[model samples]
Target: MDSSSPDETAPAADQTDRLILEVARTELGLGANGGADGDLVVLDDATGALTRAALDALEGTQHRVVVQETSVQHALALAEEHRGALGEGRLLIAGLEDAPADLATLLAGRSVHLALARLPKALAALEVRASSLARAGVPALIAGGRVKHMTRSQNEVLAEVYDEVHATRGLGKSRALVARTARDDLRELPPRSSEVEIAVRGMRTAVTLSGIGSVFGGASADAGSLLLLDALDQAISAGEIEDTTRSDGADGESDGAPEEARAATPGEGSPAVLSARSVIDLGSGNGLLAAYLRSALPAARLLATDDDLDAVASTRATLESLAADAATSDGAVGTEESVGVDAGGRPGEARVLWEASLAGQAADSADLVLLNPPFHDGAAIDATLVQGLLDAVARVLRPGGQLWFVHNSHLRYRHELESRIGSVQQRARDRRFTVLQATRS
Candidate 1:
């Protein structure tokens, strides 16, 4: 987290943030005497600028403001910058998936009078926020988003939980959807479920995965992931990568994988078997890739990490569902303690962390890393976003480790991988996607 002062960054709040603040203060009387008598929750302030200004604006007021950010990086930055800003209030690092329960628990008897939020990209994310605010018994919510991103469906989603939903006039191409009167009948949005078939050790296996609305692709496997999976399957079939999950023609069990299938030993001028002992799913969005890895390499230690709290929680749920489905089909599966999965929460073997780009991981720890880096930084197309991930992967990969990377064809990440990690091989290429395998030298 940066050590810069929050006050210094408050001015950096963009047009959207400024308009949201103006609407809240002028239209809603947010900082006035008669308004916001109860609790106020601020959501999705990425830079902590909006949050910092809100805290200062509400100073000396009876209304206690709660600051919540889904991104751990943003949350930590805000916490570090504003140590004493929340005198009687609370700063929470949570997402729509966990924020409601967390906020409810923290504010035991308190009811939220108002919620100010920057709108999320996905309708499912919007639905989650609306449902969460409704559950908190919020009287009014002023949600702002860029005019280009706003849609009629968003209003419909909010209307499901709120009695009235209407958009305010556009200001500088940004607008706010003011929703009032929380509906009496509101239920939390359940995780969406979908079945996807992926090639596992040359076998077509169908797995059911679930993800909250906030998670990317919302439980459905994306095309890029499918391409990467196909590349992995091709490698295993060609004997370049050992297939530990191969069935023995009788039961689904491998009894015990051969010694060659259990280790990745690369000698001088000898072909290396990519039997990874430890694996990482970088930017594990909905845990789709992580869930696949768990079933494909049950003995390997897996770590699924994401920057968003929603992704972390969604990955947890997806893996838990995988464990449950596996247990029912092939007897019981014990929870592995090596990965730090709680014994009570579904049987899982992957340890999930909420961190941005392998921040705390030690050097030379992972044997294999699967990366499908997100190209977008909010609304902007930032190709440099993957640079940080490539750097982290270079540090964390061992001498004989491998990185399976997938990206858009136009991105041409081959040179990037060659320079960052080691020798890069184009395993698969289609019209839109390219899957590459890079070895750590």
Candidate 2:
């Protein structure tokens, strides 16, 4: 984290980023003379463009700049790519319970004078970000976004955390929201909750889901995920998929075929039991899919991973809540041991991880992977992310492992899945969403 001279040809800020920088500079009284006495924090700049430009603009100034990004992938990129420009102890992975002592110390005591942020689309996300800065005693914030993406709700969300909130005039299709006078008694947004019915051991069971503002779709169950779950239930009941939990095997391949007898044990109407030993819920937003898997496949070891720290926390909360609900249900749906870590400190049946695209996942490791990938990157639609996600999931899946994927119907990801992963089968499709089951080659 040592500071060096910024790269001469770093990515420049776009219109929105530039406007944010401009507003921040004006609000902080950082004029051409470059004499300011406080630190700065930049939020959610995925490209590192805003951060780099800020560093260059603040060069030789009294103020220090630290960037806080929710995505581990983005944070690592900023640290590695902009190593020359970013100073040591200048980057913080926000929303972590155990942040580094030095970073916490640096940010403590209302030291951050201002924050420049790319306003998140979700009001909850914006509120969470704003409340943190306000709680830390940052006096002002300059948040910008494309004019088309900006909404009145953003102003309202910020107003709740600050004494004053106003919008800037549009600048080349970009605009900013300036909020000042951080409130002393700012309240943190509570995690939202919703319930969705998922097939658990051949029975329709309602599972509670929880998420903070940053989590995608909040606590509501995504339609695509629901479709995927239905497909999984059908596949398992038809003996198309089975729990091939091998106790001793290095390769992730199922040697045995259709277990005709096990399907009969569940009876005529009930869904077949899935004893999959290892399951990965990639991008486990709000833990909806992971919670479903936890109940549906109790014996399976569950691993949930997400890029956003908030989403990871949301997943943990959702699963933990599930375990708590189970404990008092009097032997209804799931057991107390289904979701969290055991008393011995070892992870129980389910584990939630904050990582970038299966960062340290081993090849051919998981028996089954569930994914409901987001097509949009922030406010803009981005189809490229799907291919990258598919590639990552392919590497971790063992030979003959299954990837149960769901996506918007318009995205038409079947060809991509067929080419990158192995054979692809359309498990379910409606007017809006498509569910595909791809087998690892």
Best by lDDT: 1
Spell out the clash pairs found in candidate 1: none
lDDT of 2 at 9: 52
For all predictions, the C-alpha RMSD in Å is: 5.5, 6.6
Give candidate 2's error at residue 170 in angstroms: 4.7
Off by over 4 Å in 2: 1-4, 31-36, 46-49, 53-64, 84-87, 93-110, 235-275, 328-347, 376-384, 409-415
Whole-model lDDT, model 2: 0.71
Residues 147-244, candidate 2: write the lDDT tens digits: 88888999998888899998987889999999999877777556788888887646888888887767888899998898889888767656555543
Q: lDDT (CA) for every model shown?
A: 0.72, 0.71
Q: Candidate 1: how many backbone clashes?
A: 0
Q: If scored against the real structure, what TM-score would every candidate get?
A: 0.82, 0.78
